[model samples]
Target: MAEMIEYNCPSCGGKLEFDSTSQKMKCPFCDSIFEIDTIQQYYAEMENSDKSTMNWDTQAGTEWQDGEADKIGVYSCQSCGGDIVADSTTAASKCPYCDNPVVMTGSLSGDLKPDFVIPFKLDKKAAKEALNRYLDGKRLLPKVFRTENHIDEIKGVYVPVWLFDAGVNARMMYKAEKRRMWSDASYSYTETSYYSAVRAGKIDFELVPVDGSTKMDDDIMESIEPYRFNEAVDFQTAYLSGYMADRYDVSAEESIKRANERIKKSTEQIFAQTVKGYSSVVNESSRINLTNGKAKYALYPVWMLNTTWNGNKYTFAMNGQTGKFVGNLPVDKSAAIRWFAGITAVATAVLFGLSFLL
Candidate 1:
């Protein structure tokens, strides 16, 4: 058995769970809500310990082996006493049996500290509204999916990301041609001139983000990017109070390949813009080299929803900072056929009317 601890309500000795709506600990049986700060103070007084170090653990999730059960901690739901095996990076989760919010405080305050974080700007209500707007104006989406999708689960999570900064040295060669045509006194003349274009430049990129969690889909995750790095702030444990967070399992070295690809593409596009005043231009050869490349760990806020319809799972994600939403919806085949038929009938009627007038 792993270490299990329960939080009982102070008023009725009932189990307490964190409420996302009110941002407080609530007792289901008694319907009593308590402030987390007050509860922390009380717990500190009872235990006769330092208040600042309540959730701090200097040596958490340093190493794990195949058979090392000690590395994993089983959290017991305060409401139902149900045990949940939370991995090293999972900061908050709900109990499987009772669905009560459980915060693994010890998991977040360890050696895996992030250098920066972007706090959530939008709440649960905003996420729901964004989902409704996303479903609108999409004719191909199934009608039943719209009505039946009650959103099985919606969570606000801080996804781990690696930000890379690098200086680039790039050189590119291009073949350019200029053509002139003239016709005078029944004689046609054409002149073609060819030139070589070479460009060499150095540029620096700051804070190119790459997803660090293996559970997240790279392509889908990058779809909602451009997280305004200027608004980022230094990491503080207090931000993790009411939201869920994940730690980095993929190291910076492993994520360099993705960062380099984007850097190379951007470099080529920037240099290509300088070539002008030519009828045609073709790239002959190109090379981009990266130097002073470094990576920093950070957390970005996102609101995610997961649902299943007709045995197919749909994932919707919203940028918590910018309120951008993206997801793939199932297309209705029957509705598509009806739409095509309706268009054909309308077109045929208009064509017949025009022929009668002619």
Candidate 2:
């Protein structure tokens, strides 16, 4: 059985939920709020609490006849003591009996704990509004998608990611050419000068994030390019109160290949910027060496929506910090045909007018 933790309001003992607007835990019943720092102490004590009192008598419950409960996991809610049944990958969830947010402490313990977390900055309401704005000017989007999509299904999640930092030393050689053209009364002259350019420098990159969960599509995650790491705080289970979180199943070692690829690409681009003031430049040879590479486990906030339209499921993701939204929408074939037809008609009319004038 997994252990669950819940935050309760100190003032009125009501269930405390994290409020995005206030950036604090607010009690729904008493309206009292507490800052994150204050909650940190409570979390510390919970972490250091004695485990001897947690032993449960296993002989009381009925045994599973066979492999019936293989995929199921049960957790004891700290607040209501109700059994919270969840899948193996669920790190955080809400208790149905008492309606309090619960975090699976065992999943986030020891080596699995995240180092940093970006709390939810945009609430669920903002996500819905962003979805509306996303669909507003999309002329070719299916009209029925707007009416049939489930907006309320949108959820805020703290997605696990690996933030990699490294210092790169690169030496690159480029072949560049400068061309000059001159025209005289009798003859035209053209001269081209070729030069070999070499650039060597050291550059550092910080917090290059790669999605750590296999369940999230890497392309969509990359499309929402950048979460502000400056706003990230030390990870606390309290911050995940009202949201769902995934414990990273992908090891940091497995993610190092992706991190290296991104760092190498960035190093090449930055070095290429230095080779300028030429008509054209092409890379001749390049060598890059990386040092002090490190990876940190962190959670970034994202608002995700999954909807099915016309028998195809669409997934949308929004950056909770920056409010950037991205998703692939189904295009209406009829509307696309009409739009292309209009373009063709205009082009033919313009060509005919030009021929008549000539």
Candidate 3:
């Protein structure tokens, strides 16, 4: 049976929440910090003690008691397992979750729904203003791209993501060097010392999010990071009334690889910063053992726009809550060439004038 589990703080019988800023599980009642491993172990022992199995009837769509279902039409995207709901009169031409063509299909009866969602704080007008601001003050951008390229689509989407919580045991070694120099009347002398540095520690990572959509670019998505987890609320189908959402097509297992990569990189960098007082430090080897590796499914809000120019597509995305915008626009090659030539001409002319004066 599908069960919703809430982790309680061991220090006090209160709900334990993942604090994004501190990257730890904090108990509001007792003001205690905990490693996620402790909670996972507790849940595991509880499951083992009670071995009875139960089946639950999980209905996908929300039951409509007010006869509002007649006006709501649900469609699915073929490229990605994105379920889109809109008004019956409005045609869903593209999947807002991934910006791909939509194919009408039945509701996701077997899909796992998100546990939490961060509703859109910024509206379409804010997104439009942000897009315009992003286009402004860019001289290299083609004038036509800024003015004539119509935004093919702009959508507010609840993107699927996997949030990972883990406690990691890390060991890192580095080759460090110290340099000293002395100058005498006859010659200069230099001395260098090399040493091996080793460090090991345990650190916790809370709510490290990885986008769970196949069509979304990982790098581009990461650029708009750091959703305030504190603002997330219990998931409800009513939140999807005016927005689009999707069930994860990429499983948590597939998404874990990227999370691990990012966590490992972060661990190494954080530890390296601790090794100070050395002129130079280079990583020799590092190892990380992850424990309490847990994943929570969530939906994050994003304002997305897609347009085509010169047979190529350009996409822009904004964090619906923070208004952090990120997208790569097409560069004007002719404009760049002209700029380069103008700078070179001015430099050469100045040099010639100086030579004549001399």
Candidate 4:
């Protein structure tokens, strides 16, 4: 077991501190850097890694006693080379000044690495405004929630994600049937013919994205889709300077499996579209290749706000850096019903008057 918290400056031998906003445990003394990957290696070298890794599925989660000294002592920020003081138990934070997501960098002692990460670029004020604008256009919402639901407390969080790009040289062989109809004087006969063909093409999927946390579900992450991978700069702690970030808990190996599943589904659809008019089908052969596999441990931005409506928790999220709106909205059902009923009654009266006039 390692010390619960430890800080040392490698460059100047001065004390170091973790910056929650920058997402890096930086050596304020020397600006020398390190990331969570270093800690994982440290413990792994000592064969004492289990003390740091926590199972997300468990209720107690990580069993990280607030001050447990046995936990992995330190994490360095990969982006900034800063030393980050991570709660060996908790998963998320931002650097105090730089806004980098200093997260646990790796989980694998075996073979796996992230393909890529979409960094956070939007700031807090911009994210809040995005949520407000999303609310503004929505009609039939409670006036209170529209205005009273304060976004002041919306925490800017950057989630972990995986990105993968593959070149698929697809060779699909299938059998298909086409239908034809011919009309006699009084009746029509329909005839169907079967055909066999092979379709082959190469598609280069630039960057298919996947979210890497069970903390927030994939559905919401997908909702805020099309992360601009081309705009992705090399992962930097400065990008996380003013936002929160979660370390990668789900493994890259696990997420790559998911990415493959998505690719398979997409491939099937593409082939189906190409081979139309098929009553019954058979894909005798299919091929896909993961070309130029690249992965990175990255932090994505999200604005999480926990609001209560009638004793239930309604969590709201806006893309912290992009300002994309997400999360379950808080609503007053009684107010919604009243508004609907009132509108219905007025509409009914108008319809009745128009009918009478006609």
Candidate 5:
């Protein structure tokens, strides 16, 4: 049996949900709002006051057929006593029967606990508006895609990410060339001088995030540039309310390789900037050393939607904190052809007019 925690309003017993707009837990039924710290402290006292009781069930239910229970976890909802079936990586979700948000305590206990969490700043309304703005000006976008997209299915998810901090020392050597040209009445002369430029420096980076979920596409996640880490708060079960969160299936060791790749590229670029005043420069050799490397676990908020068009699936994501939206849309081939033809015709008319003037 899995343990679950559901936050209920102390005043009216209504389910409390974390409200992005207010940055606190608010009860929709009673309209009562409480600070996250207050709610956590209140619940802690309530838990300490309660007596522990355990009831065991010795009877066995219908056995799960072979391979039937793989990658599935079942938890009984405290609010409605309904069994919540979810994926193995799911850490938080809402009860379908009672609509009460639940956090699986065991999933986040011990080594699985996240160090920080950036709560959703923009609400669903903002995400929807951002999607509309994203699709508004795409002239080549298929018309059927807009009408068929399931916009209402958009969900806010807390994606687990690995944040890495490291200090890097880089040394780079570049082969550079300078060119000079001179023209005389009898002949033209060109001179090219080659030189070696070397740059060495130490750079430090903090909170370089890499997505920890295998279900998320790496390219799409990277397109959502950055997340504001200053607004992050200490992770709490209360913040998981009214949203879905995934546990980190990818280990820090695996994620560090990507972090190192990013750090290496950045270090090279920063060091290369110092090699200037050359017509052309080519990197000849480079070395980067990293020290004081560390990794932290955290959850970042994202709004995601999946839609299928013409037997293909399209995914869209919005940064819950920054309201930046990104998605790949299908283009109408016929419309693209017509647009190209129009451009060619206009160019031909302009060339004809120019030729006539000449």
Candidate 6:
């Protein structure tokens, strides 16, 4: 319930704020920009500041942790940032100036040391349009909702997500089998070949994300994906000057567990493909160890749109950072029935014509 506020940029006396498209504190006046700090970006910079591109596989010391300190306090974007005094749990928001969902990077970091992130470049307004366009395709929507549902309800929320990068050393020992068929008879050959392969490599992950909100439902929230993390910028409160933020419900440890699960699933897929042509199954001693484990913090933008139909709340979400759309919509059953009837009548006429020809 916090009101949207605005302030002038100190440098040019022009408007500045968190750019949903860039995830940075940007000054539209002078076009002065600063980057948002993430563990990956920070470490990447330190790891490769002396080199060309930041390489994740490079052996880095544990002292890499010290590089990231409270020295880089969360900046308040006066030009593009603001002092958001709203409660910690406010997840959705709007930019007072542009009236777009301006996700404070904090909302994405969600008070957790981020495991990873993919920040948003798209603003809340564009995100709302994504929702509107998503809604426009649903003809079964109520007329009132189709036309009157305000995009104003769209709140720019920076859903905190975890991105984990680590080197996994996997050792697997298993048995395999193949099946041969001839003359309608099948013969299964169990080849108990004790083969052990070493899988060790560093994984440079861009954005492994999770919702920072406990209020945001997982099934609905997860429908949206593909946040462009490459254009992410440094955290600035100025960018959030206009939007809203949700407090985190998912803990870092929990998110990490989820991320690890994802990594393991992906690993299994890779291994499965590596040992293709197996008919029965591949089973054995399998273990994965995470070396060079690291996490980055980021606030990605999302436009959260909430609507009510027949006194029931329906929700829609747009990736403020990437313009991806997702939500639960109230379908107009009456409209659907009418359309179905029309289609059915048309099909009936076509059938009659075909019968006459026959």
Task: Go through the candidates in order and give each one's C-alpha lDDT.
Answer: 0.79, 0.85, 0.74, 0.59, 0.89, 0.57
**Residue clash pairs of candidate 2:** none
Give candidate 1's whole-model lDDT.
Answer: 0.79
Per-model clash counts, in order, read: 0, 0, 0, 40, 0, 41
Pick the winner on lDDT between candidates 3 and 5. 5
Angstrom error at residue 181, model 4: 3.4
Maximum-TM-score candidate: 5
* TM match of model 3 to true structure: 0.69
Model 3 scores worst on lDDT over the 10 consecutive residues at 101-110
With a 3 Å backbone cut-off (N, CA, C), the pairs that clash in candidate 1 are none
Stretches of candidate 1 off by over 4 Å are: 1-72, 76-82, 95-106, 183-190, 337-358
Model 3: CA > 4 A from native: 1-111, 345-358
> On residues 1-358, what C-alpha lDDT tens digit does candidate 1 reach at each position?
3322345678997667555456567777898988767776666576576533223233565566776764466666656656687776676666789765555666545557788888777787999999999999989789899999878889888888999999999999999999999999989998999999999999999899999988777776698898988878777544554566777778898998899999999999899889999998898999898984668888888889999998888999999888899998898999899999999999999999999999
Model 1, residue 70: displacement in angstroms?
7.9
Cα displacement (Å) at residue 88, model 5:
2.4
Q: What does candidate 2's lDDT look like per residue over 1-358, in tens digits?
A: 6677778887887778889899998888998989988987876776689544676554566787787675466888777788888866577888889878888877788998999999889998898899889999898998888877775368788889998888899999999999999999999998999999999999998888889988788888788878888999999888888888888878888888898899999889999999999999999999999874668999888899888877788889999999999999999999999999999999999999999999
- Shift of residue 127 alpha carbon in model 2, Å: 0.4
- How displaced is residue 353 in candidate 3, in Å? 8.9
How accurate locally is residue 77 in candidate 5, as Cα lDDT from 0 to 100? 84
lDDT of 4 at 260: 77
Candidates arranged by lDDT, highest first: 5, 2, 1, 3, 4, 6
Clashes by residue pair, model 3: none
Candidate 4 at 235: error in angstroms?
A: 2.9
Q: What is the lDDT of residue 232 in candidate 6?
A: 64
Q: How many backbone clashes does candidate 4 have?
A: 40
Compose the digit string of candidate 6's lDDT tens values, residues 201-254.
434443566655676666655677766666665554444555555546566667
Error of 2 at 316 (Å): 0.8
lDDT tens per residue, model 5, 1-358: 6677889999999889999999999999999999999999999998899957646362477877787775677788888888898877788998999988989877788999999999999998898888888989798998888878776478889999999999998889999999999999999998999999988888999999999999778787788859999999999989989999888889999999898899899888888888889999999999899874669999999999777888888889999999889999999999999999999999999999999999
Give the better candidate number (1 or 2) by lDDT. Answer: 2
